[model samples]
Target: MEAINISYRAMIILYALITVPVLICFFLKLGNVKQILIAVLRMTVQLAAMGLYLDFLFRFNNVWVNFGWVILMIAIANITVNRNSGLRTARMFLTVMLGLTISAFFVIVIFIFIAIRPEPFYDARYLIPISGMVIGNCMRANTIALERFYASIKKNEREFLTYLLMGATLREAALPYIRESVKSALAPHLATLATLGLVSLPGMMTGQILGGSTPIVAIKYQIGIMIAIFTAITVTTVLNLLLSLKVAFNEYSILKRDIFRN
Candidate 1:
């Protein structure tokens, strides 16, 4: 069975639904109606551009090209994580990128090469989408972990120094903050996992179903992607924190104030 396509007029009609939220925001004096409209416009333009680019990419599907695209995605994700986490990009970019690359590629190798094993293992369709999913999740997780960890230490400098003064090693002193940050980073994903199908259909599964795949096939893909996302996030969060420790702190175990943007 082929998937049904929405026509341009249908899409325009769908976009018209934004008025509902815009009206509600205006009524509530939210003052974000402009922001909402701008966001919608940006999303529309970005997706349209991506759609064109992806069409070209799919047609020109070379292994090197696909691999290069994945690298680009990783680099973009790294920059975004640094900016959002309030970390100085110069200090943490390479370290965080390394962690992200390791985690994303590790899971991609298993998921794309071992599990899915599409006709051309490096098919752009599978490789690009899966890598984006993994890298995107890693970006968000690392942002939360880094922000929470550094913010916690900065806020509780006395407590952290007290731990150090009480004969704790640098790693020991930072252990509590590390645990807290990692937990905070993973909590949302864990909750989503726990309530996945019961709460609502996930994007991957829903997209596959809409694209005419059998329910079982969609479910299998969803399961694989979820596991891949979770593994990637966990590894990236922990690895980024640990690797960043080398540059985030001084030899005397002090977090460099310069590492923060603000």
Candidate 2:
């Protein structure tokens, strides 16, 4: 039941497989051949570098190193969420990080630590990947929520202002947009969760199976991770948007124009 290693030659063949799409893009004048190649090259370089560092980290397996790496990932994710969501980076950085940290506490402490309890508790192989999954999904959800919330209020400023003028509190006026953004951010994850096994074998389950876990065991882990991801994304997105109301608005409840980078 041991997994077979992929040889370097197999990797080279995989890289070569991209040539078909590269040629098609070239002939179609897609003008994205360079972009495609750059993306692939970046993916290759990043994963390769990560592979080396992960090997080092795994070998050493210090508790501090593992937790520090998770913190770094969250910090990076926080910044990206701020920048992409059009929230002023300096203004939203600490707020975003706090939201992310809180969400991480829920996922890692409750699910990973209490439920799974992988040996050594700080095992990088388990902690790092699970942290990455939780943090990464939270980043995406936060970006969507913030962007939609702010953009909606900005685009419908008159409507928002009218709501406030009608004696509605700031929270009441903002509730509509907040609900919309949360719904928008959560829709895809919901659909994916619904169709998980029916549509396709989830990547984590597939990887675990390939790594020689029994199919039933892999499914259990997959279910746990999916629940972790969905919950993390929901809590992070809602918390971020709620906190953002303070950071993104003026005392009079106006969306700050200067907060957007673009």
Candidate 3:
């Protein structure tokens, strides 16, 4: 299949259009123009670099290089999740990484190896991109779950302790916060699924269609991907919060301030 190509002039024009939001923000005094501009610039640079690297990866098709690239993505995602969730990297990095890697790997492998079964099983074309998508979403969900779970526990420390004092087990005491955090983390995915066909065309399905797949085939792929994403999120969020309890609290079952980013 021939890949679509965009010329340099077209890319420049596309980049120029990004400033419309920045300009509007400046006039509206939203005070985020600088941040918006910087974010756009960073996104452009990062995506450009990733595209180039992916092109090379596809060309080489080396198993080791592909595996290493996936690992690198997981590592970068680990740091990003911790940093964004306002957790101290030194404390939660490994835990977050483990939660994400385990769940994402499980879902991706099952889908690629058992379900999809793209030839060669470890085909970079299928394995890397699908894993990247699942892992990226899992990282985000776990970060939110961990952050909110710990934050809620700390915010309601008195209530949490009261439950423990009242003879509730640690799991029982943490259940409320865990429920809330899990709901909060999963809400976006639920909402997306609800409005999926009406509000917007999903990127993955659209890409498949554009890449020469039939609409029915694209829909099937979309369904499979969504199932994988949902499974990954559910497993990672629960496991992440469950695992986080070990490090997030002291012997007294009290949250430790040292675990936060501040």
Kindly report which residue stretches of model 1 are placed more than 4 angstroms away from their true locations once superposed.
none
Cα lDDT of model 1 by residue, 3-61, tens digit? 79899999999999999999999999999999999999999899999898789789999
Better of 1 and 3 by TM-score: 1
Residue-wise lDDT of candidate 2 within 1-262, one digit each (tens)?
8789989999899999999999999999999999999999999999999999899989999999999999999999988988888777888888888899999879999777899898999998899888998899999998899889988999999999999999988889999998999999999899999999999669999999999999999999899999999999899888888887788889999888888887
TM-scores of all models? 0.97, 0.96, 0.93
* Candidate 3 ranges with C-alpha deviation above 4 Å: 1-3
Model 1, position 159: C-alpha lDDT score = 98
Q: How accurate is candidate 2 locally (lDDT)?
A: 0.90
lDDT for position 95 in model 2 = 80
The better-scoring model by TM-score among 2 and 3 is 2
Candidate 2 TM-score, true structure as reference? 0.96
C-alpha lDDT score of every prediction, in listed order? 0.94, 0.90, 0.86
The candidate with the higher lDDT, 1 or 2, is 1
> Quick one: RMSD of model 2?
1.2
Give model 1's TM-score versus the native structure. 0.97
For each predicted model, how many residue pairs clash, with residues at least 3 apart or on different chains?
0, 0, 0
- Those runs of model 2 whose alpha carbons end farther than 4 Å from true positions after fitting are none
